[model samples]
Every structure is written in structure tokens, then in C-alpha cells.
Target: MSGCHDCADCPAAKFPPPPAKAAHVIAIVGPPNSGKSTLFNRLTGLHQKVANFPGVTVEHHVGRLRADTDREVLLVDLPGVYSLLPHSEDERVTHDVLTGLRPGMEPEAVLLILDCTNLGRHLLLAAPILNLKLPTLVILNMADDLRNRGGQVDVAKLSAELGAPVALISASSGEGVDKVYQFIQGTAAGRAKVKAPLIQLPVLQDIPKCRRWASEVGAGAAYRAPEPPRWTRRLDAVFLHPWAGPLIFLAVVILVFQSIFAWATPVMDGMKTLVEASGAWVAPHIPTPLLRSLVVDGVWSGVGSVLVFLPQILLLFFFIGILEDSGYLARAALIADRTMRKFGLQGKSFIPLLSAYACAVPAVMSARTIENKRDRIATIMIAPLMTCSARLPVYTLIIAAFLPNRPLLGPILGTQAAALLGLYVLGFLAAVLTARLLKSSILKSGGTPFVLEMPPYRWPTLRSISLRLVDRARVFLRKAGTVILVVALLLWVAAHLPLQNGKPPEIGQSFAGQIGHAMEPVIKPLGFDWKIGIGLLTSLAARETIVATLGTIYGMEGEAASHGLQQALHADLTPGGALALLIFFAFAMQCMSTLAIVRRETGGWRWPAAQFAYMGLLAYAGAFLANQLAGGAVTRLIAFLQ
Candidate 1:
């Protein structure tokens, strides 16, 4: 009844044929913990771009093959998933793209990367993908690890079993990756040649059938699963123990905090001297007074202050990258599950929360992997409460100014490092309490099971860790140049306005001063003066902006003009005010970028609005209390010592 009587006269006959050999756009996909990302980086190097998929906050990496030829292949590194079935946002994006249902360049072929050491389970994912029947090359990554551990797999036999070509490579060390390039180019060239289409395999509709198929395919291919490494089992015995595990994790945290101060001090000082020398060298070149002031006092001083802490921030990320790449972070998550359950969160939330230490934007976006909506929102809501790198400048500035560098634990930890660690603990405690409150109230939901595959331990490669630090530094420097630079220029204009006799007014009578004075009454209870009030307002753009704001203001002031930021702050803020500032930053939601991402993730302004108001109120009350109590205690201690 629905037959097309005019089939020969259809629109297909009128339109021109598609290209003979279109540019190849291959997809690199695999299960979590597979060496897919490493392979992608190996093939693309620094010639890659990252952007979010359409209609979602999830990001995908697009890169061209780093080949020395005219022909190029565009590779989309889709989010890692175990199967094509859409359980979470990541899986859904991968599924849509592979199926040609999404608005993007459909993959001409797929590079199915999997860990050869664990072929039984990894091959389970191959079933659904092979049914799609695209030109697929099953890339068994970590071949060196497999062979070192006595695992063996016949690549030719495996290729025959799956009815697709296969290759083995060590993505980390760049071993045998040329086979990947060959396959890509060959697939592209083959597109122009006509051949008989292969018959489609029956669909794998259920997990049991898929599993049976995978097992049979493995048996046929002579796939031998690798023996678990001896060191991994031994390490797990201690690191994954019931009681000792958490204590070890705590010790690791303490070591990281102590090292942040002790190890990074000299590097920070060197950076500070370099910034000052550059400013001094350039200050005399500008002829006009206002131009000199803007260049030397405003832009250089403000941005330079934040740049000094780059060493400390990178040190923090260095440790994080090592922990993650070494596979200890996953074990840490398992250990934290017990405590997470007590606070109404699951173990799966730990990774995102831990990632928040570096930045909250990606941490929030990573929550798309959580299956439960309520649990996902709760993680998003509390992610900002973690002490991110933006808070490092404020914390280090205040701590270094007020707290002495006296050693608290001999050579292990110092007074300043202890103070920094306490601030971190305070933030984490606040996040847990807030999670408890939210989970018990509006966002309440039933507990969902958290199952994560434990990755084998491996020594972190230097190349990977260095790459991470480089990326972090680029992001930090970019912000300093753009956002911080623009803010400094605007502040300088405001601080020198309404000139009398064509000369700049004193800071007290300038437009910036009047604005700060108006807000002074509101922050007076927290031991803040007019200058700090101005810094607080500007900090809403970014938490690190407060440091830059203070730097610009102090550069304009006459007193302590030659001193560094630490001395300038000591001249203005009391010990209590210094403590209050740290407490305020720990509790406040001072990042506009974080707020915008939260709004996008939650799909409305309600969550971010509520989050902003709650954090603001908490910061004010906490700072007020610290000012009243700690101020007196510190004064008494100083007098007693004298």
C-alpha cells in the first residue's frame, strides 16, 4: 500500500553524486581507562582543538593526524564509554555521533582502542560497534605491558574473528603506532573504489548475548588475558585496606600541602624578582605621567602579583596529575566511599570533587557521567565549595603576610603550610556538610549503586605529566593577560578620575575611593577598610582578581611604595583582618565563570542563584566571627610575646 510508484523519478536521480574520496573523519573510542587519550595525543600532538558537542556541555576533542603529507585525517576523540547504549550523557553523545543521528561530521571509520591485557571484557564493547559495520580497526593498546606480563594475542586471528582489521601498539611510548596511520590512509583511499558490501552481522541486543559473543571471539583469536602484576596486588593490599587506606590518603594530602609551601618558595621568590625587575626597566621609558602610571602601576603590578604564584599552582597540579595518572586516585575514591555514603554521596562523586581542586568548570562538566539526576545535581552544587587554584593566590598572600614561616613539624611541615592545609580542610568540611543538608532536603533521592573499574597501577610518564602542567600554565597566563589586564586598566582609570588642575586627585578623593567608601560600612564588621571593600567587589569577576586589585591599589598609594605585596598588606590590614579575608575567600562564591557554568549545567538560574546567595551570606558571617574572635586572640598573643 505504501509502495513508491515513481521510484525511478525520485530526487536522488536529479542530484549529483557525492565525492569520490571524501576526507576521512575517524573516531577514536574505547572504554574508560583504555589508552585512547594517549593514542590520540600521540597521533595529533599539539595540533588539536577541544569543543563541546552540540546541545550538551560535554566536550569532544577534534584533531588532525600529525602526518607529513598532503592528505590529512580529522579524528574525533569521543568520550570513553563501555557500550553504545546511552546510560549517561557521555555515552549518549558517543552513541548519537556514531549512529549519524547527531549534527556533526559522521565518522567515516572507527579506531576501536582497547587494553589488550584485558581482552575478555574490553571485547564486549566491540560487539555493538562491529554491528554498525563501518570500516573499523581494533587497536589493542598497551601491547608492551601485555607482553611484559606474559599476555599474548594473535592480531591476525583477532582480525579474522571480528571481521575487521586490527593492530597492536603501545600508545604511551609511540611503539607500532604507524600501523594506525597506515590503516587511516588506506581506509580513505579505499572509499573511492567500488566493491561488494559485506553482509551485516546480527544485532547484539542483550548483555548476555554480547558477553557470549565476546568470549567465543576471544577463544577463536587465541587471546590470553594478562596476569595481574605482582606489584599491583602488593600495593593494593596496603592502599586498599579497610582502616590504613584512609590514614595513608590523609598522610599523602599532608605531604602535598607541606610541599606546596616548602618546595615552591624559592621558585616563587625568583618569579617575584623577575616581575619587579621588568616593571622597573619599563617604567622610565614611558614619557607621560598618566601613561607611566597605567603601564607600570596598573597593568604590570596587578597582573605581576598573580603571576608570582604560578609556581605554587603548578606544583599543586603536578601532584594531582601524578596521583591520577598513577591510578591511585581510583583507589582513593574507593576508600572514600564509606565516608561519602555517610554524607549522602556515592564514591563516584569523589573524582569530580577531587578535580575541583584544580578548577570547578571541568569538574562540574564531568558530572555528566553520573547516572542519577539528583545525585548529579548535588555534585554540581557542592563542587565550587572545594578550594580551587583561583583561591591559591588569596590564601598564599594572606598566610605569607600574617603567619610566620616557623617550622611546625620540623622539616616536614611549617606554620604557613599548616595554615594553608587548615583552610583546605575547612572547605572540604563545608562541602560535606552542605551535601548532607541538600541530600536530606530538596534534592533527596534514593541511593544508586557505584561501580567503577579499577585500573592497574603504572609509573606515570614524564611526557604526560609535563603536558598537563603546560596546559594549566597556558590557561592561567591567558586569564592574566585578558580578564585581569582589562580589569586593571578600568581600575586605573577610575582611581585617577575627576582631575583637579589637570593632575590626578589623591586616592581618597578619586571615583574608585568614593565607591569603596560607600561599601565600607557594609564590610566594616568584618574588619575590612575601604580599599579591601573595593577589592571584594572586583573579586566577583574572579577570586584571583582580589590580589590583582590590591596590587593596583597599593601601587597607586604612596606609603610602602617600594615594598612587596606582603609588606603593603601588613601596612593596611590587622592580623584579624588578614584572617577574616582568608575565611571569606574560603566560603564565598567569587567566580563569575563558575556561576555561568553552574547555570548551564543545571538548566536554569535557580541553582546558581541559590548557591551565590547562600555562599555570600556564609562568607560574611564567617568573616565577621573570625574578625571578632581571632583578632583578640592574635593581639593577646603578640603582646604576650613582646
Candidate 2:
């Protein structure tokens, strides 16, 4: 039952009964970041099942891969782990399933996904699989990436050393997949357990021997690496340089933020024109003012609100996909490690926090990679404090309206971009502080050391990155369609209903307006008016909803110009109030989706509830400071200039 081997004692060896007809279970196992998920996506494409692995929250994906005319291989994508020796939930789940020890689950064969880019370390995991004596096919994923990066893997010798088939395939490009089917068809080898050399000891002393054995097996495959990790080393030289590395990373981050506003401006303006044109064309044609009002103000306004954010969302995800695929994020993580350790996190935390800029739900979920319970929870708790894309619309709305588009420091960076960058930096600082507090107080499993595997660099296909971008857009649009759309509908209904003296209702007299008024006492000290109060209340569901809610709220008041909301925000909000609002959103865990995900990932309500409370207090305090500090400073500067 030991996960280390599929010998005579293994359940897999006994169950199939030497009959080729017996259902052959195939498990895909690997170290983290080896593109196993990418391979799973290719092999199972739209034909997969996702469920919990027995008692744990970790997902188990089961899919069918065709073997031949007679049989279909059941492919289980085991959770990525380092070795058969269990340390975390992922490792435990993977081990139980591979050993056939978990109730009703026994994988008869294994497709060990090894990184050709890092074969030596991968062999540490692969060695134990070979010991299981089960038919093991070592898959060299990212082989193309390795070769392109000036590295090589001797598949022939690797197969010989392990007595198993090895396939070099670029799972990302969908290349060399047929080799897998062909190998499965030849299934004569690997079905019966071989007497793989067994390690003599389970104690700590023998760990080096296992790794040494792995090293020896790897040596035959030239796992010693056929050549110096030339390109990787060169790239690392610049990217991981003590001075250049941090500088380059900061510049890249700034460039990413600048492009979000710069590149997306054209599309955003175009959408505004389209929405205005559509509203203008359709508004005059309707015979009745009531129907016309609903058509123009309710639906179009709601739809238009969400549309404004589309460009930013699409571009943000596109950049993230490129950075992730190019393997530069690993470099970024490395660079961030020292800084992260200061805040009670490590390099491993940087990716999820970076991802939080796009959205916090997946970022919180990504924290599971930390393995340490306290660190994982701390990461989750502060992930929302990162400047997610949802906050982009709100930031832009406030900035574009109030802040002049004048150049800062003589045109290299504009005031708006600088302000935007400052907000991002602010969010990062807040997250660092929050993590420090959590680690020092609530979650004090301090400072666990971890290694980040740097994957080989490749020219990732634009098509693949685009496909991923499209997926992100789909998720955003799905939320827009479901949650934002419903909230918009309700807001519209509340604003238009309860007519005053048989005429159109004044928005201030409507149901939503009353709610906004009730919230005014709480928001007033922060310099926000009742209308801002309404947007704040509505946006509790989704951060981006603030933009749409503001758009809808203004549209209800019959504000119709293309730049109407922007101008309105400029006119309605004092510089202090606007700054306060932006600062508030910078720290607020306002997205219900983020809260729900934290609940699911933590398996309780307590953490999510705590997250909401602590983040709320931070948002309030931060806003109060921004209101007091920025408002007075701006006024004094204005007076001095005058």
C-alpha cells in the first residue's frame, strides 16, 4: 500500500489480474509548475470531471484519453506535488491516489510529468514512482521550451535508465501528443510491475541516497544537463541582478500600469461613442417617454457602465498571461522574495498578490500553494488589499475627472499615471502591513522557506495567450451578466419607481436614494455625499459595480453626455472626497466573490468574516487619513499657486 512502489504487494498489481482488458487507470503526476495543468487541458479538452479528492477540498480531475480501438484510458490529473513522501494536502492526495490506497481509487499506470528544463530536481519525485514498479511513462513537458532555451534532454537514455517510455512534447503548442496514444497502444510494457530497485531505509539518513539514486539515473539521461543552462543563465543575469533586477521589475510593473490606461484609452473612448450613439439613435424614436427612459437610462446605462471597464480588464489579463507564460514571473518572484520576507511572506506569495491586481478570488485560491496554514491564511486575508482590476474603473473615474492630465517630471510619466501608480504602491504597502500584522498576531507560523522552480523560457504563442485572455474576459463578462446585471436592474427599478405626483420620480426621493441617505451619516465624515453613499452601498457586491452604479445613478438623473459621468464626478466630488473614496477602495475587501472564495478555501466563515471586518476598518481609517491629509494639502497648494 506504500505509494513508493507498485510491486507484488501493490493493489494495482493484483487488481488488473494480468488481463489487458482490465480497466487501466492512468494518473498524471508531477512537481508544481511543470505545465501538467497545461497538458491536462490539452489531453482532456472539455472532457473532464472536477470533484473533491475524497475528504479534502483539493479538486480531483478525471478524464478519458483514448488508448486505441478497444480501450479508453481513465486519466486522472493528480494534484502537483514534489514527492511520494507526504508534506502537504496536495502531496497526500496525490500519494493516496497513486498507491491505490484511497478507497475505490487505484491508478494502474503513471505518466510522470518531468520538467526537461529541470530534470535533476524532477528526478527526485520520479525516482519514487519508478520504485513503485508500476508501468511509468515519464513525460518531458516543456521539452520544446528547454531546447529553445539551449538545453537538451536525452529521451532515449532516460527511457533506458528507467525502463519506461519517455515522450518529449510541447503540451502548450499541442505538439507530439500522438506519441502518447501510440505508447498507450503499445501498452505491452509498464502494465506488469517491474522489480524496481527499492530503497532500504525510510529514515532521514537515506534521503540523500534516494536523491543520489535519482542523480545517478539522471546522469545517464545526461540529466546532468547536456549543456550549461546558457540562455536561462544569461536572462537570469539581467533579471536577477541585484541592482538591475529590482529596477527592471519596478519599471515593468509601471509599464504594465501605464499601458493599461494608455492602450485601453482608444477602445474605452470608442465604446463610449458607441453607447452614446446607440442611446441617441434609439432615444428619439420611442413614442413614449416612459419606455424611452427605461430603454435609455435603465438597460443601456447599466450595460454601458460595465462596457467602460472591458478594455482595462482585457488588457490586464492579456499582460498577466504573457508575463506568466514567458516564465518572467518566476524571476519576479525571486526578486520579490527578500522584500516579501520582511513582511512575513516569501517569494511564493508574490504571484498570488500580483494576480490579486486582476481579481482576488483566484489569488486567494492560489495561496494554497504556500502549504503552511498560517501563511496561506495571511496571504488570503490581504490579497484583496491589492489593487485588483475591479478597482481600475473607480480609480480612473475619479482620476480622469479631477486630476489634470499634465505631465509629471517633464513628460516621462504623467500626473494621472503617477497617481495610478501611487495607488498601486499604496495597496501593496497595505498588503505588506496586513501580512505583518497577521503573521505577528493571528497567524504566527512565521517564515517558512520554499523554493520557486523557474521554468524554461519560450516564445509563447500569441494564440495561446489570446485564448487565455478570452477566458478571463469570459469570467469578467459572466460576472457582469449575472451579478452586476441583476444589481443594475434592481437599482434602476428603485430609482424609477414610486412616481411623485404622476410624473417621473426624482432620484433623491427614490428607494435607493433613501438607502443612500441612511448611509450618509457613516460616509459623511469622509467627505462623501449621499450619491457617493449609494455607489458605495451598491458596490459592496463587486468593486467594479461602483463604476456601473455611479453610471446608472447619474443616468437616472438624466445626465447623458459621453463625458457626463466623468464631468459629474469632477463637479460633484471635492478633491478630498475623491481621494478618500479611492483610498477606501484601495484597502476594502468589498467583493463578495473574494469573501466566498476565502470561505471555500479556508473551509469556514470565520476567516472571511474576519477579512471583511479588518479590511473594513483599514479602509475607513485610510479614507479618513486621505480625506484629512490630501484635501488640506491640495487646497493649500492651490492657494499658494494662485
Candidate 3:
């Protein structure tokens, strides 16, 4: 349990409230895709923090709502589920909390968010929850969608059918949602009633009785249904077409990648210019040489190199937001479902896998949504291979270095966009293929069918998109501001140390260079030298640190440091080295944070250790192959052009 700190004489502690003054708990439970998350966000807004349920890795969102007169409502949004009879880990978690079976969890009331258009079916879930006798309110989201389709749920009759107040609302549009919140605040203390199941339990087939009773209740409530699923059928035809759907999904992904490079170029350039100007202005004013160097080259330059990529990161999130909020991502999942089944995964795994492109840690966390154990573990295992945004910096740099930007497939698509698209495709292929291997060999699990509702397309609100954008920017900057900052300072010291005999320290003789040199022999096979070795070593903390590490290393050099990193690489690295490094990063397990999260999720070092070993081998092999193959192709192409 969580409580508000600002409230005067708040009766509860932050968590695990004393039994005598047990904190009021309200559970927001619903079936999957029933607008559970949307309602939670609307109720709590950005004032929410997620923490795991007592002992489980499954996290619940806790938020506060203003209640009647100088108090706040503590809201716990539970995992989405079909019924209290749990089949999945998440469903089990919800059931335990509601039943007081799980330790440290006791709910005082429940808010049931149901899909309005399918009230009869959604209420089948409500019957059991209602029997718990917790003060409950039924929020029928998608009421607007239902109404537009010439359907309506009779609220007055529904309030009578179930012994709970019913609110007709569209969580997306904020229609009647306030009433639901007010109901929670007003009734949590005394309204919830624990009682027997509403309909008599059937002797042998209780499930069918539940269904029949739900239909009967629908009739009693005068539940109105919309027009037949004609448009949905038609839309599914094109979007879920056996062959065309996948192609459309592919095109959408390609467009996103192209936009990342094409749309963000000007912004990226502007950021680069700003950093250079700041460096120029700030560097000469400092009095001491070492202090000035640390401020300019170590701090600003290292941080700036990574920060310039924020535009591309933001643009990527922007497009992803559109896809998700538009409901097309669900269709994309449906389209991928066919191939996913062949690999022993259902469509449920697709969301987490898709989310991996943003970052693997959260994607892995999102795997809790998947019901099956093996399926969840499998998703977590291959999630890191999804070509996350951290790879964007490395990819952009390498593509700029090795690949010429000639227009291909006419003037619209360039070699740069195509190459970038190709890398993402490679990552997808790698993830699917690796999952197949793991499913058949290590994990050895049977396939589970994917069950999901295609949420109606809602135009994403500016507020929603803006909130997400702010959250993403904060995460990116926090990583840059903290981890990269510390690493940059350390790398600066490493590159500037060991001055001896009154002569200036050389990078090759400094501690950092010596460390890089030690690993140089090992990495030389993959077309890397000591400087790249240093970047690779530093990147164990974070993938983005490679850029900062390289910036710090190069910034320390006398004349070479004056050149931009791209130019320095152009003069120093061969096309083969650039391609090989790109391939390595595309496949490598570079982020220690990802591995740590995996270990935590899997509950042991065994899985993360195996993940590290296999991913490392693959990265090394991939880099070596890229070096050889790309080197051969470049030589032959040059000969032909000559």
C-alpha cells in the first residue's frame, strides 16, 4: 500500500500499513485490452509509481486521487485478466490480492472496467468479482465507440442488474470517467458488499451457466449491441491479410526507420552546432589547463555527442506513439501472430518484443503480460536483440562512415535509409530465429494461443503523447546525465594520467590506452584497434557510453582531437572496421543493466550468464563475417567502378 505524504495526519505509512489502520486499497481490474491501462492513466495521470506486489516481480501501479474533503484515494491498478479463476501468472496475482490470499495485500474495494460494446461478455467476468462484495463500480469504456455504432448500455438497468453503480464512459475521451473516480472515493469505505455469486452455480458446467446468466443479465439490463462487425471484418481483411498484412507492417517499420534518419537530420545537425559553439565559448575562459580540459572535452563534449541523438530518439517515440494510440500496433501484432506461432509464441509476446526497440529493460518487464512461463522467458531472452535506440547512434555513425548516401529506388529512398532499414530487419530476423532455437532447444515449450481484443482506433490525445514524450526524454537524459557523466570523467582521467620524466603523457602510454592495447590483439580479428577496444570496454555500463567514451578519448588528442569524431573516424578507420563494429554492436550484449534486469527477472544468474555467452559469440562471429564479406564487396565494387 502507498499513501500521500502531503496530507496532514495521513493515517497510513508509505507501505505495508499497520493492521489496525490498514490502508484503503482499491483494485482496478479488467480483461486484457479493455482500456484498463487507459482508465488507470486517466484516473491517476502522471502521478503514479510502479512497484512489485509484495514478493512477485509483477508490478502494480499506485496512484492517488483527490477524495472528499482533505483526503486522497490510493488506487492500485491490478493486472488485466479474463476471470478471477487464474490461468496466468498475472491473473493469479490479481486473484490472490482480491482474495486476501497473497501476503501483504488486502483490497477494500474494486473498480471493474469493462468493454462497453461487449457488456454481456465483459460482465461474465464481473459476476465473480461482484460476488466478492467489494464496493465496486463498473466503468464501461468505449461507450463513445459503442454509441457511434448505434449501440448503448442502459445504465439505470445495469445499476439494478448488478448491485453496483454503473458509469457509462469513454476512458479515451474523459466522458463520465470523473463519476467513476468519485464513486471510488465515496464508496470505498462502506459501499462494497461481500456476497455469494449472483446466479446459481451449475452442478457440472458452471462456466456455461456463467455465460448463460451473463446473457440473461444483459437482457435484463437492456444491453444494446452495435451493428454487425462489418467494418471490422473489412478492415481486418486488408490489415490482417495473410500476405499483404505482413508487407504493410514491413512498410510501416521501414517508413519509421527512414523518418528517423530523414526527419531528424536537421535537428541533429542543429544540436551538433549548439554543442560545438558551447565548447568553443566555454573552453577558453577557464584558467587552469586540466580543469578546462575536464570541463570542455570530458564533460560537455562527451555528453553532447550522445545528447545530439535525442532528436532521433524522440522522433522514434513519436511514430511509435502514433502506431500504438491508433490501434494499428495491435493489428501489426495480429499480423505477426502467424509467424510467431510457428516460433512457439503468441501475439501477446509481440508487444513486448516490439517494445524492445525502445529499450530491452522495460520490454523485458512488459513480458509479465504474457501468460505462459516459457513464452515470457523466451521473449525476455531475445528481447535485447531488437535493435533498440541505443544502437541508433552506432548505426548512424557507421553508416555515415562506410556507406555512401546515393539515392536508391529513385530519389526518395537513399542508401542511408535502406541500410538503416536493413539493420532493423536483421535484428528482427535474429530475434525470431533465436527464439525458435531457444523454444525448441533450451526452453522447449509448447505454443499457447494468443487471445486479444483489437481496441478501437482512438485519435491519440496531445496530452497523452506529450506525457510519454516527456517521460522518454527524462529517461534518456537521466542515463546521459548520470552513467555517461561518471564514465566520461573516469575515461578523461585514464587518458590523461601517467605523465613521466617531465614530458607530456601520450595516450598510448596512459592507463586507458594501455588497457585498450591489452585487448587490441583480441579485437583485431574483428577489425578493431585499441581506441575501439576502449569504447567497447566502457560500453559494458551502457551502449550509449561508447559514443561518449570515443568523444572523451578523441577530445584528449592534440591536433586530431580538433576534428569532429566523424572526420577522425573517416581519416583513421577503414570501411571494413566501421562495418564490423556496427555489426558487433547490432548483435552484442553490451548493456550491463539489461543483463542485471534479466537476472532479476529470471531469478538466477544461470539464464543471464547463458544469454551473455551466446550473444557474445554471435556478436564476435557476426562482426568477423561482416568485416570479411563487406571488405570483399567494397574491393570488387571499387574495381568495377575504376
Candidate 4:
């Protein structure tokens, strides 16, 4: 500054000083499964913006809340970290933001959330954060659980001992959250303050010293850790059993698979009917043939194909939420750890992979929590292989067209549901094989022991589950309205170009058809025709886009009917071809967003390029083999039966 001031006559003097940050940023930090996200959702409600932090792959969420005076305050929900030490990318980003090392994201205050039931242990994290001398509110979450388990802590004493205010709140239930808001309001008004500790804190760099100091502080406050919940222990005994656990998990998977097919069919049929009706009603009103085709065949048919899967997607996420809220997913992770290690992956990889079933983008981002570099890369590489919700539309369309919905095993399972479950297992097996190969080769690294905190099981609240579904629905509809809509419109335009006698030409004679024809020979071995080739090209934008592409193509070709996309596909595909298509999608890296995320997470195109190429080859080979073998088998079965 002195040098710059002295050079006032220089061009540098014309530059203005950097604008001082004015927003009061309050950071919410806690260890994993401590209900931090629940609290964030509670405080922010629907007013939040999500983006990546500068120069990092980590996601950032900033939400606005109104203070007592009606002034706005910004809350930054940081990644959950056990410590301020930079062990993983998540921890590093949190550490940077808290320490002001991350430009423009420094927090004015901290909401240090701790699991109240395990306060003594969670207190260890408070030392380094308190030393930062930020106006901090040490929030002991899960107050209801703590009291129910017969634990107690003198909040005033704890506040005095730690030299910061403490608030006992159940973030999930919203009890005592008002105090958190008050602390936020006070901090925003510059009224919040922290006193000198009653006992001197150890240096931030000294782990053992800090641990001892934290324990002493807790004792001074008369903190008592809660006894483990009885049902939790009992359930753990069964759910964590080596053999029974896997069996139980298998049963749960089967139930979910059955429910997806059994329960969602009615809703899907209703939605399909509604979409068709809308397209029919709108078509006549449009008057112009070209405009009518664009509106009905392009927009309506395209988006509608993907929209029909909304019920199934929501159903999948519903089970995931219940399992997670019930605290069973943590147990599932522990059970999967034994098998994961054999494939050169740790238990942490399983979480991202499990989440990959919902979507791979967030799952890849979730791998940031894994401390090991090689493990994180391996998780990201194989994440796309999992059968995500996007594949549901295509899978269902193909299955309904070819596979009969007859009972298997006395109606506990059905042919359609079994086929769906088989596809899921197929994806998981492919992921494991790929992970093993990666770990054996370039990404080879020694294993890191898995450690996880098991949260106490609780009944999932209706509010939380509904909020999750609503959020998912929002994302789904937004994609349909934007990306899918645009693709559908483009496809329609391409199909109508080079008009004959000022009317649209046959789809096979249009520009889109030419591209599909050119690619047909390349995919012919896999039993895909030019129409499927066109769908495949569009699907690169997203795994679900193929449904929209096919919907538009078939609608324009006058093949779609009252039965919709499934009926249209039945005429175009053989049983072997449909099975091959499912296999191809199960293995392929069909999502561009996933590739972009991989590139960002890996910090280069080299990894994503290699990933795309490897998966592409595997998908091709798998589909080709399935088409050849299954084709002959199916043909022979028909002849033999005759």
C-alpha cells in the first residue's frame, strides 16, 4: 500500500481499492451426519443459491435470512468436516473459508454444530474454531436425542468454559433454533462477543494437547455423554451381522425394485395418458402443420417421455431418504466395506456409488469427503456405471415393450421387476470390476481404514421427505423444460429441413436422418438402427435425453400411439436388441454433465477423456455380445416351443 501510494502519479494509482466485503457471512460447520444440512434447510428454506467455491471443485451454498430488524444475513453451509485440519478436499475448503484464506468467502461468525449426545468427543473440534476468535455459537445439536438418552449439559457453564455462547438445539425438529437465529442477528449487528476461556486452550497445532483441554472444558461444564440408544444397538446386532446383513440388504433391494415397478405403474400410466391427451388437444388448435408438429411432436412428446419417469425417480429417492434418516445407510456402508476393499475401494466409495443411483454428478462431488486421492478418483471413474434415475425411463420403456409382467417366485417378485433388478446388479458388478482394474494399475494405492459415525435412528419427518421430493422434482422439471425442450426443438428443425414442395420431408430423408444413417453402421453390431443411433447421439447431453429424442423421432414418424413410446419401440426393436440397448446404457458414460464434473474434479480432460473412451468401448462390446448371444437364444426358444 505504501509503495502504491508513493506512486500516485503512476497508472496504478488510477485503480480503485478492492471493495470491502459487506455481507455478514455466518458459516455452519459440523462433522458428517450431525444434522447440519437439516439446519441449513430449515434456516434458508427456499432462498438459497448453490455454486462452486472459487478455484475448488467443492460446492458452495449461500442462503439469505432476515434478522430481527429485517436486515438480510447470508449463511454459508460449509461441507461437514471433523476437524479444521486439511486432510481431505472438503476439510481443506472448510479450513480455507474459516481462516480467510479463501478470497471473498470469509465468514464473520461461526455456528459450530456438535452432536449433543456425544458432546465430549465433538468438543475436540471447538478448540481450533474458537481460537479463530470469530463470534461463534457452539450449537449442540440433537438435544431431543440427548435428553431422551438421559444426558445433560449446563449450557451456561459450557458457554463460560469455552469462552463462547452455547445453544442446545435439535436441528431436525427446529427446537431452540430461534437462539441460533438470535446469535446470527447479534453477530450481524456486531453485538455478539466471545470472552477469554476460563482454561487456557492448547495450541491449534497440538492434537493431544487440544484433546485434553477439550475434555477438561467439558468436565468443567458438567457435560455427560449419552448412553447409546437401545434399539440402535439391537438393530446394529442384526443389520451389521456378516451374513445376515448382506441378506437383509439384498431383501431390501428386492423390495425397492418390486415397489418401483409395482407401485409406479399406475401413476405412470395416468401421466402418460395426460401427456398424450395434452398433445392431442394442442395439435388441432395450432392450425399450421409445421408449427403443430413442433409443438406436439417435438416439445410435448419429447419432454413427456422423460416426465413419465418422475414418479419412479421420486420413489427411488423416497426409499433412500427413509434409509438415510433411519440411520440404516451408515450400517449399509459398514457392511459394504468388506466387499469394497476386495475391489481396492474403501467404504467411503460405496456412499458415492450408492448415491450414483440417484445421479452421478453429486455422487462424484461427494467423493471429495474421501481423503485418499487415488480412492476419490476411482470412485469418480466408476460412479457413472451405476444405474442412475435417468436410465429408468429407457429401462422401463424397453422392459415394458419386450418383457412380460408375469409373476416370478409366487408374486413376491415379477419378471419385469426381476429384469430391472438384474440391470441394477449388472451396473454394480461393472463398477466393481472397473474399480479393481483402476486400483491395480495407474491409480494403485494402499487402503485407508474406514471410519464413520453412526447417527441414532429416528422416524423420518414428513416435512423433510416432502422437501427432498420437491427439490428433486424441481430439478427434473427444470431439465425437461430447458435442455430436453431445446434438444427436441432442434431435432424437429433438423427433421423438417430441405422441405419438399414447401412441406416437411420424410424423417429418413432429413438432415437428422442423414446423421443417424451415417452412424448406423458403427452401431449395427449392437443391434441398434438409425433411429436408435439418432437417440444415442442426443443422449450424450444427458442419460435421460435419449427418451426425449426417441419420443420426438417416433412421434414425427407417426409411430407413437395410445400406448405411447413403449408401443412405438415394440415395432422397431427385437427382444435381443432391447436387451442389448439396456446393457449399453448400463455401461456407457452418457451424461455430459458427469464428464464435465469428472474433468473438474480430476483437474484435467485427460482423466475424463480416458474415462469416456474406456466406458464407450466397454458399452459397445457388452451390447454386441448381448445382441448376438441373446438373439440366438430367444430365436431358438421360440422355435423349440413351436
Best by TM-score: 4
Tens digit of lDDT per residue, candidate 4, span 237-339?
A: 8987878988998787666656565686788779989999999988889988988988997889667856776776687678767877888877777777777
Worst 10 contiguous positions by lDDT, candidate 4: 3-12
Computed on alpha carbons, the lDDT of every model, listed in order, comes to: 0.77, 0.72, 0.74, 0.78
Model 3 CA RMSD to the hidden true structure, in angstroms: 6.1
All-Cα superposition RMSD per candidate? 8.0, 7.7, 6.1, 7.1
- For residue 447, model 1's alpha carbon misses the true position, in angstroms, by 4.2
- Total backbone clashes of model 4? 0
Question: How do all models score by TM-score?
Answer: 0.77, 0.71, 0.75, 0.78
Q: Tell me the spans in candidate 4 whose CA falls farther than 4 Å from its real position.
A: 1-22, 241-247, 346-429, 442-447, 479-481, 520-532, 538-586, 589-611, 621-642
Order candidates by TM-score, high to low.
Answer: 4, 1, 3, 2
Over 4 Å off in model 1, which ranges? Answer: 1-23, 190-205, 241-251, 345-429, 438-447, 479-481, 498-500, 524-532, 538-586, 590-612, 621-642
* Residues 88-123, model 3: lDDT tens digits: 668889988898875445767788999888877787
Q: What residue pairs clash in candidate 1, if any at all?
A: none
Tens-place lDDT per residue, model 2, 331-370, is 8877888878899887768766766776676577557556
Q: Candidate 4: lDDT over CA atoms?
A: 0.78
